[model samples]
Target: MIFKMAWKNIWRNKVRTLIILISIVLGIWAGTFILAYAFGLIEQRVNDAIGYEVSHLQIHQPDYLLDNDPQFVIKKSTDLLNTIKKDERVKAASQRTLVHAMLATASNNAGAKTMGIEPQGENTVTQIASCIVDGEYLEDSDKNKILIGKKLAEKLKLKIRSKIVLTFQDTDKNIVSAAFRVKGVFSTYNAGLEQSTIYALKKDLDRLLNLKQEAHEIAILLQGADLVTDFTQEQKSKFAALSIRTWSEIVPELALMTNSLDQYLVIFLLIILLALSFGIINVMLMAVLERVREIGMLMAIGMSKLRLFFMVVLETCLVFCLAAPLGLLLAFGVITYLQNTGLDLSSAYGESYGALGFRTIIYPQLQAVYYLRIMLMVAVTAILASIYPAYTALRLEPVEAIRKI
Candidate 1:
């Protein structure tokens, strides 16, 4: 009976009721869309970080990561790699002989981290072959061939087939210089990576370093990101002597960013709800004031103050009930369309996003839980917003309210 009365009462003043409903609908729709976009952006960053930069997990000599010394190579890396490959959790693994070195050409020079990689293994693990914009990925048969980033190529004023000198310390701590022709030039969203890293065949690099069949690091990609912690734990038990790290441990900032964004989304939604609350409060209060005589008559006829207060609260809830589903549907439609078409900010924000290693196109995504959460929040907001107006109705003196116009 109270719900039916509340529903009829709200429509008695159609203009005011509709104004509040519109506010609720727009607020929910905007808040949901914004949150979805933010989630998509962060998700994209995590994917790119895994796909291009960190892979899922890494194994290295205990001190190799401390200074990246060429001599701190993983022992019997081939056997270890084969063992890792046989693990069902692992999608792919690649061994790398990394050295900090100076890369130079006739016209220019720059310090770079040169990575020695097996072509086939690297293709499986990092997918570097797909990023090649010029020339070809390093091939096992291509002796002394190197893959440089397009940024580095520009800095060195070199192109494909251009010869470059790689000078680094060999295993004996002796400075060794080797000549490599730039067989490929690749480009990635990360400017720092593009300028500071290059790839070469592991055999060629091992021969130069005089560390046969050893590697400085083993990069592993898992079938899914959720498997990272479990796989890391298992690998730790297997390779107790070597240091194993997951992508999150290696890049704590990415983990922190993802967590922080979740908190920000909650805060953002609260702000939207806060704004919508005021409109509800205003409309409900006006409804109570305009119906003073009717409320007085009901109280005079023996209706309790508690019942009056509840009727007002029920009215407020009905407003939200009418609007919430429509708002959610509109938000869902927009999100689904954008997920397929994508929102392109590339032209306007490409350079900034590229520098930070983020893609310019974003596809918004929202989980089912988010919809449920938003609906609960809106319901809570309606209840809270009704309190003050309901109190005003409860305070109305029956004789005084009945005498008023």
Candidate 2:
């Protein structure tokens, strides 16, 4: 009986009730979609970082990156790389030698982290082969051939077959300058990498440095990302001489964003819900105020205060029940459709986003558990919003309310 009364009471002021319901619905839908968009952006960035920039794990000499010294080459690197590649968990592995060098053209010079690589191994791990926008990929058969990034080519005013010089310090602290012809120009989503990095054949570079079969770094890609932590730990014990770090260690900022994403999104949703709750509370209060005389009549007819409070609380719950499910369903449908179609910011913001190492085409997504969590939050908000109005009804004096209005 009380449920029927509560249901009827909420609809008594249909226009006002609708205003609050619609407000809650829009708030929830907008909030959820925003979360999905943010999630998609981060997820894409992480995948690209792992796939294109850094692999699942990287092995480096203990002090090699501190100053990019070619002298700090990994001991027996070829054996280490060959052995590690045989692991069933390892999808691919590659060795690279690094040098802090200057890339120079006749009219320009810029600082560069020049990488010495084996073409086929590099293609497997970093997929640099696929990023070539001009010319062809590096060829193992060719000596003194180079791959330069697009931005670097633009900065240096370079093109295919352009002759450039790489100057750096060798292991003996002696200055070494070598000339190479640009074989290919590639572009990466990371603009910073484009301007600061270049690649040459290890066979050619190692001869210049007078090192045989030595590498400064070994990049390993795992069959599954989830194996990173365990593989890193296992390798650490196996090769305590080398520094084995996961992607998170190499890119702390990206890892931090991924780890804290959920907490931040939940807080953001709470702020939106809080704003919607205020409007809901005001509408609920108005409903109670206008029904003062009706409430008094019910109390005078021996309706207990507890029942009155419960009835008002039920009205608030019913209002939420009417709106939140529809909003959640609508949001879920939109998210599902967009996850495939994606929101392409390529037209307006592709360059800007790619410069920051992010993909411009974002596919919004949310874990299924988050939807349940949002539903619980809405229910809690509804109950909390009902308290003041239910308490006001309880405080009403039956005789005064009946006589006054």
Candidate 3:
């Protein structure tokens, strides 16, 4: 009967109830959006760091991973690649041989790292096809076709179909010369990769390095992030001679970015929760003060103080039960809209960090567990914040409160 009366009493002051409800709604919105946006930014960083630089996993000669030497090449046959492809967990795999060299012209020259990759295979391993900003990606038919970075092209005065000469030292400690026609020029958001790297058909590197049947590394693309660790471990156990590295391991900086983002989000959420708790406590206290005389009368009329306390607490639960769903609904609407039309942070982050190594587009994602936790915390905090006000109301004296009112 006290619970029923407390709930009915809450609606008597519609304005105050609305104020408290709106506060909760606004708090939920703020917390949800901030957490989602931060996670989105970190996710973009991870994808670009992984896709533009390292594929999900890279299989390298143990010596090459430990000691940076051109001689450390994967001498295995195509059978190994075939075996990996047959694994259901593997989406795509490609071979690459990376070398550092000077690409030059008569009036312009620049030092750049070159990657040799099979065009089709690379497309499978990386989003290579989508990254073609100008002209076209590498074509196997063109024996000497090259894809140069936009920044490198500018520095070396290169254009599509323009001839560029590359000079590099082979594994045998011999200088090799190769001329390639720039088939495409790509602009990446990462300035470092754009200024220092180039790509050519795998056959070109094989011919240049005089290694007809060897590759330096194998890159694998996985379907999703969850399976990367397990797959990397499985591959390492199977291929002991090869060193396997996941994207997170290959680029520890990205891991740091993710961790920092998560930490910031945790702190941000805590602050918002604290603000909400204060709002709930204030509202409950005001309501309790307003009803002190009625509470004291009920306690004097044979109603136990404990029952009066539970009544006030029940009133808070009632308010929360009514407001929480509305807040969650509002949050869901806003998040869904923003997720479809992403908030652009490109203007601040710049086009590329250093070179053609990272992409700029970001997509927002929220896990089911994130929503569950927020909902649970909001409900629990509301219930807990009412306790002090409930205790205060129960302690009031019947004669004093009634006479004062």
Candidate 4:
């Protein structure tokens, strides 16, 4: 009876109810929007940084993972590449030979790592072609041409078609010297890649190192990023001699940075939610104040204080039970629209994410747990926020409440 009376009383002051509902809506919307966008941007940066440099997965000789020495070569890389390519999970695969040494040349010199790549195959799995700003990406047709970092090119005072000499220890522990023409200079938002790496044709490095068909690593692009773990496990059993590694395993610093950012954002959102809970408390208090006479009448008519308190608390719950789902629906609608249209933060933000190794465009995604959590938080807040109001109604003297307006 008390519950039915309280439910009817909630709609008596329609304006006040609307005001509180609006506040709840706006608060949840802002929190949802900010958290979703921030997470999306972080994900974009991590993937871009990894894809731009590391692809998704790599296969190397068992010892090469321990120490990436030029001498640690995969003897039958072609056979392994063929076997990996046969897997339906594999999107694209490329073979690479690497030499880690300082680059010395007339135009510029620095400690640099050289990566030998199959140009066409790399394009399928990497953003290398997009990174090229000056000249063009190295083609298989260009035997002696190399693509270099813009910073490296600037340090060397080199231009397109300019000649640069590379010195590194070959597979046989001999210092091999080779001359390469600069086919292009690539610029990345990634400072590390822009400063210390150079790319050359696999054939060129194969000849320079006097290698017949050996490679240092095989880079694989998976269809989906999350599949890296499952694919790695599958590959481990399929290829016995090689070690499989994901981008996160190879580059832990990026993972650490993104993970910290995610945790910070989650904490910040929780604070906002707590603030919203206080707003719910204020509204419930006001509802109890206006209903003192009604509460007193219920008690006079033989409704127990304990039952009245429970009813008032249930009233608070009904508001949240109705509003929370609506809030979630509204949040989803807003996020989905923004995701499809893409929040045009690029113009205002201006590609500042290059340092973080992410693209300017951010695509929002909804995780099931996030929405589930929001629902739980709102429900708990509504129930707990009514405690003070419920207590006030219980303490009211029936005669005094009836005498007052």
Give the per-residue lDDT of model 4 (tens digit) for 181-229: 8899998766668778899998899898877678998999888888989
User: Which TM-score value belongs to model 3?
Assistant: 0.87
Window of ten residues with lowest summed lDDT in model 3 = 353-362
> Per-residue lDDT tens digits of candidate 1, residues 1-405?
888899999999898888888888999999999989998888988888888778899999998888878889899999999999999989999999998889989989999999999999988888678999999888789999999988889989999999999999998899999999999999986777788999988898899899877999999999999999989998899889999998888888988888898788888999999899988999899999999999999999999999999999999888989998988899999999999999999899988887887888999999989999999988898899989999999999999899989
Error of 4 at 40 (Å): 1.8
lDDT of model 3 at residue 155?
Answer: 87
Off by over 4 Å in 1: none
RMSD of 1: 1.8
Best by TM-score: 2
What candidate 4 gets wrong by more than 4 Å, as runs, is 1-16, 101-107, 150-157, 188-191, 225-227, 253-268, 321-326, 344-352, 397-405
lDDT (0-100) at residue 72 of candidate 3? 84
